[model samples]
Target: MTDVPRAVDRLDDLVSLDTGEIDRTIFSDQEIFDLEMKNIFGRAWLFLCHDTQIPKRGDFFEAPMGSDNVLVVRQRDGSIRAFLNTCSHRGNAVCRAEEGNVRNFMCTYHGWTFGLDGELVGVPGKSIFYKDKLDLSKHPLRKVAQLDTYRGFVFATFDETAPPLEDYLGATGRLGLDMIAERGDMEAVPGVQKFTVHTNWKFTVDNVFDYYHPQITHMSAFSVGLIPAPPDDFVEGGAKSDTGANLEVPFLPTDLHNFVVVGEYGHAISGPDQESLEVTAGTEPFAWRHKPEVEARLGRHGGRVAGHPHIFPSTWVTTNAQLSLRVPRSPDVTEIWWFSFRDRNSSADEQAASLDSQIHFFGPAGMLEQEDGENWAQSTLQTKGLKSREIPQLLKMGLGTSEVVKEDGLAFMDAPINEHAQLWTYHAWREWLRNPSWEELRERTIPRDRY
Candidate 1:
């Protein structure tokens, strides 16, 4: 017999992350991915479309929850609800359209129909076909375990045991959202930009926080001037001649500092000082940190966090103002969806310009993402081999050098961009795979501010 551990114990191996390295099997193993779907995606609060997308009664948007899908609908009373799209009678999807306004849904299989609230209201044959034996009132649509919205962004969870949405987001995740929300009267653009990539989902997640690859991986972007050339005075901290000699790259000014925030449930944020964006960018059109209120609300961490802020398991929020969801379709195939938002008060032209920036930065056609995806695809493929999978992936940037500090339910690192947040995320991942009670999970993952 194979000496396989229980699913819980196996998760430990999958999440075996230390300061300097992580196991390769986590990216290529089917068994480990299956457990992740159950213990992680199944229980955690997954981001859905914003409430504004379905403002009127009967409007709905379709969202994926792990392998399953759900319909996010707005009710007549203005509240929103989400339920599985599958029909209760025969398991066929009751709704087929990606999104639309509908008073009711009818399954094409048996003509089983349901009301806006997902209550069964019609059966094609009824008394004629079933002699009225069907208990219509007994089964309603399978509602999600919980659904909630904060700052106009909707999220849903599948486990009834999961913590409340706000509690789960904690401070770190909230800061990430706050960076976007404080932008203005912001709402999700009417439609999402969806695309697929043949790479492990973990690659997409890790890349969100990776600050080291830009100069080389995106050298083409720099060459083509998609991202502006560095200023004459820009200098990288301890950057080598090979890494820095290429151009007068506008280095993060000497005053720019990296601030990392680690929150409960594996969520975290990292960035350069909030004011750095304003002071360094000067009059650059792409600069987004000039607003005093945003800098103040973001506080010290916001000022220093130029790196991406991540809500663990799948959501990534960027300093340039974009949100990405990394959907795991399989062990080696993942879907990346981009949502671009702009202040409704901004002029239409301004909105278009903001969206243009988002598209160029990380969408399917994004210059930087194209390069990153290539590496991720090759990495996953190589890891499938016995010898290759045995080799460890490194995360050693600023490893033992990280000095963690704690405050207001967040653990932070004061040093220049370090891997502390990434390490913290893995630690929480191991605790979550064990499937502890919500209270225990919170206790185990809560930050102590120091490592």
Candidate 2:
């Protein structure tokens, strides 16, 4: 086997857990991006299409795995499997469409075809083609090392030795996913929304746990009522000013506490605790979780999730029942795919409202993400400058002062507005970039005694 380059040695300098400092080069360096594709993206259990997406026989969705794409198909046996979209013969894509129902994937190139289970079953002019030297079975698409589902959400990984999906996710990660699953008999909204954003995938991942940005970056949301106004008014005198609209609403007091859960393998859940969020944002979005039945269904930390939860590498689950995949394309480019979910049993109006919220929240035309993309893009651009990179990126707020607590089988901290979650994620990011053994990686990322 030709050896892979030594990629972990420089990681120590790139991120400093002790000081909560991260070198900007990791976002702009070609070498670091290549290594990430090999280590992080190559081994992690990445989210594929949800089971509801390809429920019928012969259904398939072309999903991205790092630089390559895979065909995620539902076999006649009702089992789901994923395989490289490339034809083994000449490495040409076997399926051209993003998703659809097909009896088999036929490579438009040389006409090699694969079954739903990824078996090589057909080849044009087989007998006349080089005396049929190619063993038909040997030319099958490359299958993922592991593919599994949790509550209908499917995921696949390229590392055979990696831990089982459940253990890898741990309670913290699953809790993030559970919030979406327990929202009734849910199914992904038809048609995924995809668009390219000029930014490092890490920026998107880290932002999932960011409660600090909404007040500033999403000001329009508050002003336009996308995020409902709080019950109490703190605007200079609890009174609307001169012209009309409540323009001077008070921001979450600088002291608003945020809760967090940092798990092994770099996953995290962070945002305001249940009460704080209720106090700031409207209660309608979260009232369901407080129902006795819903709380029991959620179980422990899952029930208490008023925060944004992020699965390591790049899968983000928001309280709104939407999932976003931040796919890394290059050091300075990332493609985002959005999957929205709604309850099947909900009234038509309810589902329609969910879809409308989903469409206007974070996809290509979403007002929120459009603004966020600009910041991420500019952030990535600055990293490419020599002098710009030297200015250390800081994530030191609430670093050592916050106390972590254990509850519902999770280790987490709840504290006033601060950078604990972002810093924790970067600390975990550094550990992943080290390319340590799974045991060591898990050991390194276990939540600290304090933030």
Candidate 3:
């Protein structure tokens, strides 16, 4: 393990909240990544396998917890548990497969066997070879500190002191999950779409709130009609700073009516205001949310905000009925996992239609991510260069220009397509990297005048 910096007080030097300029080294620094794995990843409640993924007893799913992998298993009592995959005798993995139903896990290296509940059950030639000196009870795989489910979604954390799953989710995080949970009996698609994108995980995370990039980064998406753009001289957010061009695209309208919600403890939601979108595009993108019950559950903020919602760390809920986890392999490598969802209550045809839209937009074969991956890869490369890294990355858009409006136990600001969410995430990222107490983290991440 790399030596972590003790002087977290100096975090402001790396992440400038005042100037909205972040030092580029935070993206690719080995030391910084080490700190992140220890503080951010270790403490935050990370998304694990969905409850639907391991429905049957003895079924399991291998999930990433930072650089470590854990086996999420369903026990005989119809409960879920997660444990480290490594064997106690040797560090070799007991299960080599990514996921499946198994009665027991026998390590290939030494044939030490573990039960479905991750208890050490057998060791080959224990009596003959070691006279049963080793205590099998002591050798059971190490379990996570906490495991819980909300709306059939499983999440675990290594911090015993961490808040309960629901409290940790806060208003922002719940709404993110509600985007799918409210869809009337949802389940994870049979197989997760897993792929690698050569970018720092932070890029993928902050990009979720980045509504500005779509029209430009994914212009091809609009050109090819992957994203339905409105017709003619529609303008949004006044003007694009780079080209000084208004939203004058021939195909799509410019008014996304973007909304943003920043929550305590680093959770945030940002994207096109779906209601405004339905009006401008002459289509109802989020018709499902109109139900009175769903609206009551979503509250005012959730009901009106239609866009991508990102929980702290790396869980992203996109508008196209998908939940994505950007698992960090290292500073420069991230594994993207997509869990497509459908309203199980809907007819087969409706589910199929949802799946078709979901697959084409952002999955492994999705046209949009292919473009995003290229941009994120190159953007990461620029940060690795010695001289190039000295230049600060700017998150100045709408920086200090908007006031946070408080409502329904949440804080947010409505702006004309700005980087407030991205900058807010980084601000919270720095606070998390400082390894503050959970209370302090929640306090630090509260919405402010500027990100």
Q: Which stretches of candidate 3 lie over 4 Å from their true place?
A: 1-9, 236-255, 449-451
Q: Residue-wise lDDT of candidate 1 within 1-451, one digit each (tens)? A: 8986665665555554444577888787788788789888999999988887898999999998999999999998999999999999889999999898999889999889888898999988789988999899887899999999989989999998787899899888887888788888988886788888888898887777665666567768878877754555556544447654544342443434567788888898765555444454444643455578766876755545666789988999976678898899999999988888889998989899888878888888787888898988998899899798888877776666766777555678776655676777777877877878888888988776454
Q: How many residue pairs clash per model?
A: 15, 1, 2
lDDT of 3 by residue, 135-156 (tens): 8898899999999999999999
TM-score of each: 0.91, 0.93, 0.93
The better-scoring model by TM-score among 1 and 3 is 3
The TM-score that candidate 3 achieves is 0.93
Q: What lDDT would candidate 1 get against the real structure? A: 0.79
lDDT of 2 by residue, 219-280 (tens): 78878988765445422223566786565644545656677888888888888777777776
Each candidate: what lDDT?
0.79, 0.84, 0.85
Error of 2 at 152 (Å): 0.3
Top candidate on lDDT is 3
